[model samples]
Target: MHGSFPRLDIGPLSEYREDHFMIARFSDYVHEHQSLVFPHRHSFYHLVLFTEGSGRHTIDFHHFQAEPDQIYFMIPGQVHTWDFEAGMEGYVVNFSDSFFTSFLLQPEYLDTFSFFDQDSSNNVLKISENVRERIGQLFEELLAQNARATHWRDDMVRVLLLQIFLIIEQSDAVDRRKSAAKGKNATVRNFIRLIDKHYDKVRLPGQYADMLNVTPNHLNALCKEHMGMQAGELIRNRIVLEAKRLLINLDLTVSEIAYRLNFNDNSYFTKFFRKETGMTPEDFRKSPAI
Candidate 1:
């Protein structure tokens, strides 16, 4: 889809481009501006805690129900939009990658949080009201520190932010364990990983099947069992997702995009895209995100 909202570099939060962190409550954000209706991408990571709300939040075109005590994290460059009921209450934390990467020798300092990875795209996590009490206190403290002018405000704020992340990590560990035990789709998972790494060069399901050491039929069966789709559909879906992203975010033409995505013939690319998405490349580029 095309961008209706102003991109971050041009939006009201453009000041953040020069700063490392900024925290705002939902009430103040709404009071300052009427609504955040436009779908936009940000230059920094976002941690939006929904303490009170009932509506929807869309990240990377994946829609999630907004409920009380739920938190949504957005990685940099991920596109999102929200439509929450009026009078909603929450806190929004914006920080740059540099903020967390300051003290790290290696990437593990921030990489430990896998949800922050763009691939997972940092979806929603529902927190219990009891846990929110503790976490909410920390946020309130952060808000308090954010408001008062102090010499060590930025450093102190960074410390508090890391604490919140640790809290989330501890609270979500059990959920991760349950997730690991549930579904158990290693084949599909590895297939997706491989697809991300090699989708540009490999188009055949047999190639992926060979890499995964399984017959194409077995791979298809596992994929259908977990994702409700077969091998070819998953690969095509990834290609279409990338195509849509490039078409929407870049100024490239259909032929350029086709070639950039490794299609040798533009017409064949259009037919393949049409067969998978029911729309030609031009039509799909003109369309909004589905």
Candidate 2:
């Protein structure tokens, strides 16, 4: 018999669990047909191991063809979707930020692994047969401990999860080195993170430079070197992207969105929006594609 797709809520880790980690092995009978794993954000991290079947998976804006022995690590708050065929078998592990902090705070761990990588979707780790066997063993052990209600089950699970993260970290390190040598620099990464955190509050290069503790000229130079765009252009692009997302996804009025984005006045916001986007926010919202 088939089982329902489990939501597996464990409540907050501060309540009962000593550490915020949960592991479960999925059987082939369970199929989430209509759910589509809708675009949503999470406060915890996810590590999905696809042991069998094929599908189309999208993380952030990039898409991938899913196959057996492929692993996807989705950080918190990233939008993702997956559609798998019937009889898919794998494991879905979720852990909170505090769970990782216990291990990630170590100097060696921080040096070896990047907590966030901008190109993670393009460089997913391919699990080998040996690694798959080890992971399966870990999952079985975790399930057994949970079933027996072991006194130290949470701690044991934390160790196992750390092992898995170490394996993942190795793969991420390889990808990171390649990306660092060929792609954006640390400044761009920081810039992107800042934008993600405060895009709705600030949209000026001077403001960003002040936050980064650098002169606007220096920030612009760094941006041009890594992203091949001026700092002001990047800020505008981010604002426009947020504006588009709001226009397409929410029922909020354009004026409300402009105010939410901290525009000084509605008229200026509309003018700026039209200058950055080819069409006005209203027209963009009414377009059939939206």
* Candidate 2 minimal-lDDT segment of 10 residues: 1-10
Q: How much is the lDDT of residue 257 in candidate 1?
A: 81
Q: Clashes per prediction? A: 0, 0
- Taking all chains together, the TM-score of candidate 1 against the true structure is 0.69
Per-model TM values vs. the true structure? 0.69, 0.67
Model 2 per-residue lDDT tens digits across residues 109-168: 322344344344443667756567776677677667666667777677777766776665
Residue 55, candidate 1: Cα error in Å is 1.7
Worst 10 residues of 1 by lDDT: 174-183
Q: Any residue pairs clashing in model 1, and if so which?
A: none
Error of 2 at 285 (Å): 7.1
